[model samples]
Target: MAADATKSTAGRTVFRHRLSTRAWHWLNALTVIVMLMSGLMIFNAHPRLYWGHAGANADPAWLEIGATPTEGILKVGALTLPTTGVLGRWTDRHGVVQTRAFPGWATIPTDYSLAGARRWHLAFAWVLVIGGALYGVASLINRHIQRDLAPSRGELAPRHIWRDIKDHARGRLPGGEAAARYNILQKLSYLAVIFGLLPLMVLSGLGMAPGVDAGWPWIVDLLGGRQSARSIHFLCATALLGFILVHLAMVVIAGPINEIRSMITGRYRLPAERA
Candidate 1:
């Protein structure tokens, strides 16, 4: 049986989040937003991606976004998409039409500032790493990972996993005492983001930094070199962004008031048991 320490009930309301969890959740939210925005600005400095150790403007890019005299375009291999009012070109706050890959509003400083963007990005990168490390240790010490996230053998079975997928697709959320515990899908997604995606993002980020790369050349080498690391880092960030969007949609679907309160005040009103 899954342990639900935070779900111990008083009538319909249950304590649903640890202080550590809530703290980290809020901190991570702010951190990721800043990191993402600044990273976009950084990427705008060179809107091209390649696979090898070295890449240049002259080299072929697997992906590229740029503005021609008439329109903005994003090219992925041979495929191209016109993106005039977004992506490769957009009007900034100053009424100037900008040709940056990402618009100013979506970036830090809201202007073209590679050095400024890198500073903001790198600072928050450390916050993410340190905060994540502390939260990881705290979760382990408190058995949150084991009790909440580690799926049982039965949950891992193909049939059980498929059923959860179907339920989610149909908007069938867990209810009653079941609502007090995470569904298998929630457990798996949380586990992947916490363990797999985040760590790789950090490592790939380090591989792209000149200082880190020079100090630990192996990091870049392991990822197939600096250019490859940058590409992988971009992809990982894209995945994380996707995860955040879906997670937000699920929160809205599952009663945002209750879900948000749980992370804020650590109390949740369990959904009524389906009759």
Candidate 2:
């Protein structure tokens, strides 16, 4: 695996992604999908979030997704919104009405099965943990983190970061040889998901487990409490979903052929710099 993307053949093509990176990426994609759908089904069992140490139906909920006889509503604090066709209420495949927070098509098993969803979610949770650990080791061994992900001091400056943000807002994507390497925004976003968000998600998840809470009490305390952990976990999952959507959009906008090829075959054709 090459530390940095290298150009050859008049610098038109570069070894963009390593085999390990490609493998982990695809595996992570599958794991995340299963985890998300199953988790959503689990959420359907209790479509409300609270704070502090304990929460119940009678407790004050910071967020709630439920249905009335007429329609479905999602409430965050005092703000409430109707979500009928997609969330909180929808028609099932059998033409039956569902009042779950998420639709059947969006959940694992495609039916209301908390036990089944937990089976899938817990099974994939191990994969996420083990696969992420292995990828971290591989990245360090290949210097992928240092060479590609680490931003230079100059790149970390406020002006430099602001410039990248402005460029993205203006749709001025990188091209030419510059396309081979990650820009500052890419590096920061990747780092956030890889290190900060993912790890926090795992810890918060562990806090939600009774056995883990009993044995490793500090894990729950570290996150304030079980209800707090649950809220954080939900927020983190939402953020990760947003990141995935933006990532897919970028892949489509930045030439899907080249972008998808790099992830699939570890080879990328560097786009020539824009005028």
Candidate 3:
């Protein structure tokens, strides 16, 4: 009985994130935050979204968020919603009124400079792509993607997946040895962000670049068009933001100090099971 219990608790205190993984995680986090903010600042330059091969001031937009003479409005497919201080109209740091899609606080540089924002966005974009490539190679070499992120055969069953979802909803997190490995839901979310959203973001961003489009015109064609790529980039960024929110919430719920420390130091203290 004692030997069995010892085995059960073997992974309660163990190395969770490797040094390379932790480094990549923090670097990616910083770059993603900077990119998102700067991207928003860039978006304010053209606060409209469209579909198809080409869209300009003359063409119709599928979505638009801007300030009219009367109020700030967000228009989507014939629906117009008022967004006052948060979106269209706001008091600036100088106590003067200003109109912008996203407020200064939510943007990089905190001042309206489209050129500065684009520089920041493009500079950090290379950091993200290069760091992400290194991380991906490291993960593959270490089998971290295969062993930890990929779902196991048992975890793929509908019943198993549903059970994990229910457990997560109820805050019934795993403990003991089970806590050492990521849960099915965690695995799926990581995979989606790392493999699906990140790549799509990179590709769409490239498709929007004039230099890239000039060299590889097929990229824009493959993604439908420049406008389509822009729309996809915005959507992927939004999804990444959603993932970050949920990830932070889970960290708080699970154990902020432990979870954060694990990412920082690569050591994790698994939560002990309760009676």
Candidate 4:
């Protein structure tokens, strides 16, 4: 029995990453998290997206004023109010009853606090943008990006990509290849989110900032104007969010515990058997 246990442990394979890669991975995760939380808070500030006209256009139908912004504060109003008295009652120190607004067809409880949300969002934005740039430059210098992240020639083949997809779908990924890093789909996704989408979000966000047009007028021109930049920024944020959702789903499908451990430690244990 002891011999069998020892054999099992010996059969497992472990991989270690250099300190730079580990630091970059963790910091990237941290900044992305900060961006997500603060971005959601910021989105709550606007709470609306317009297409042709300002979201506040008088004749808008597909998008109506979901919340009335009064006193520089916005709320979600009737769209998300409690039904069936599930919110319960609150009592003041004086024993007076405090009630939640019961949402009806015409009225929903609105989300508010634009000023505070913007402050938090802008603050975290600085960290993400600066930190990401530094990480990118460092990765280039160390060749970590080229060596680890860039797809291999084998990964470029349609057959290899298809095989990875099938394995991902069927939960039958091979365990032997430690050098088998990210599959094509994963490489593409990481590239899009890290290189393309994130930079766009930061640039568009900065373009929409008040007085930015004075220093970088072309940014406004590139995005078609300040308002248009805001729209694009929001769209980019949505894309990043979608990627995060898909990533989480893949982790869950692949084996949540093991995947999470690999991310945290930068090492994954491979099973003994390989055909």
Candidate 5:
């Protein structure tokens, strides 16, 4: 009886997150935060948006009537939506000047350091890119990507995807040995972040970097130009931020305590149904 009890308890397992995943996740989070904050400061320099303008023109409209921040132009494939925050500025004829403002929102004061903002932005960007590269290479070498991060062939089938969708819709998820491992949703999210959004972010950023034009003129040409690159960079950053929110929501829905513990301590107690 005792032996059976022991076996049952043992089978009621406590699955732990691999140390590498915990390290990579937190590092990615921190570096991305730094990049986002510094990027915002840098963006404050040119808070205006332009449909098309190589340089200034004599027309009043060409004078950039107001700053319309590109923060809300989120796009992936063909879908597009107005996101959050309309960055702008206003200067009253009476000589009162304001940095940023929206219809019913608060006004933000502007700073005068395009050079410094660019420097800080580029510096933090290096951390994000370098850290992400290291994490990717390390995951490859450690078999972390292959073992836990990739979705199974069967999981990629329409039936499995439909089931996952159904489960997700109902706020119920797969558990068992399957859930102990990352499900297809987790795998796809990781893949999209690492392969799709992250790389696009880095590339778009590099396209805007001044020195890059000398050697990689094609990058700038490919993305349009420096200003266009900046717009794309902002769009991708917003998408990544949205993904982070959904990721966190999933963790919470799954099990907040266990999820937080896994991230902090690299250990998660597998659900009861998981073996």
Candidate 6:
């Protein structure tokens, strides 16, 4: 009777995210949100980006957010765009004109306080680092990364990747058994985020910390310099933000309830097998 029940259940659902993965997923989500908002607030302190070892108001910046005699503008490279009310200048709820890189609504306290924002940012940075480390260990021990995220030889083929891209463009997702497994694109995305962007974010962030740099000057040197590290950190943050937006959109397109439930409960109801 137990065997029969197991077989019946297997026909409808599959174990997708593990308990550890689910926990890390939600926890990481919270920590990343806190980090992003607070980081933006920190950026408000210096709304400019530059390349090379050292940069200041005296030097040329690759990017700057400020207001001209006419209107607020965001200057990047050789282009300048009007960004009033979003980037350079905007009016607060009290009808007072304010100048900041990011608007108040987009920042963590929704007010201008770099000190308060740093506290929140640092606190969550620890959480992300510790949680990511544990998740990495668990993934290795459980062979979850190997079996699920690592692309197979066949999946690594260009044809396979192109097919996945076309399918995604056409809003066609895998069903049944295919749906239960990660596709080539999904595997690559997860690998990039986990191994590439996250590490860059952590290292570049440490590079910006005065205390961390004092202890490990090599970190800042490896990245080129303090200002360079700051620019790289901002770029990585922007990439991560893009990933999050795409991830949420894919979830909604693929079936938000089932996709979300799988992350929350570890049981995913597989779509009907395609003919």
Whole-model lDDT per candidate = 0.91, 0.91, 0.90, 0.61, 0.66, 0.90
* lDDT score for candidate 2 against the true structure: 0.91
Query: What is the per-residue lDDT of model 3 for residues 1-275, given as tens digits with 9 covering 90 to 100?
Result: 35668556844678899987999999999999999999999999999989877899889998889888868888888999999877877777888778988889889979898999999999999999999999999999999999999999999899999999998898888876677789999999999999999999999999998899999998888899999999999999999999999999999988899889899988888776533
Per-residue lDDT over 7-59 for candidate 2, one digit per residue giving the tens place of the 0 to 100 score: 23324878899988999999999999898889899999999999978999999
Q: After superposing candidate 5, which stretches have Cα over 4 Å from the reference? A: 1-15, 50-98, 101-116
**What's the ranking of the predictions by TM-score, best on top?**
2, 3, 1, 6, 5, 4
Better of 4 and 5 by TM-score: 5
lDDT at residue 244 of model 2 (Cα atoms): 93
Residue 186 in model 6: lDDT: 89
Question: For residues 161-236, could you state the per-residue lDDT of candidate 4 as single tens digits?
Answer: 8987887778665543542366678887888887899889888887877688789888878877766676788678
Angstrom error at residue 123, model 6? 0.8
Of models 5 and 6, which has the larger lDDT? 6
How far off is residue 138 in model 1, in Å?
Answer: 0.3
Candidate 6 colliding pairs: none
Model 1 poorest ten-residue lDDT run: 1-10
Q: Model 5: clashing residue pairs?
A: none
Model 5 over residues 1-275: C-alpha lDDT tens digits?
35544445433545557776788788888778767666665655544333222322332221121333433333333454453344344443344444432221211113445576567667767777778888888889989888887888898999998888888888886554445677888888889999999998998888876799789988878888776676678778879989989988998898898778877887555554422
Better of 3 and 4 by lDDT: 3
lDDT of 6 by residue, 26-137 (tens): 9999999999999999998989999877899999999999987657789999999998887888877788778787888889978899999999999999999999999999
Per-residue lDDT, model 1, residue 67, is: 93
The better-scoring model by lDDT among 2 and 6 is: 2
Q: Say which prediction, candidate 2 or candidate 3, comes out ahead on lDDT.
A: 2
Question: Would you give me the overall lDDT of model 6?
Answer: 0.90
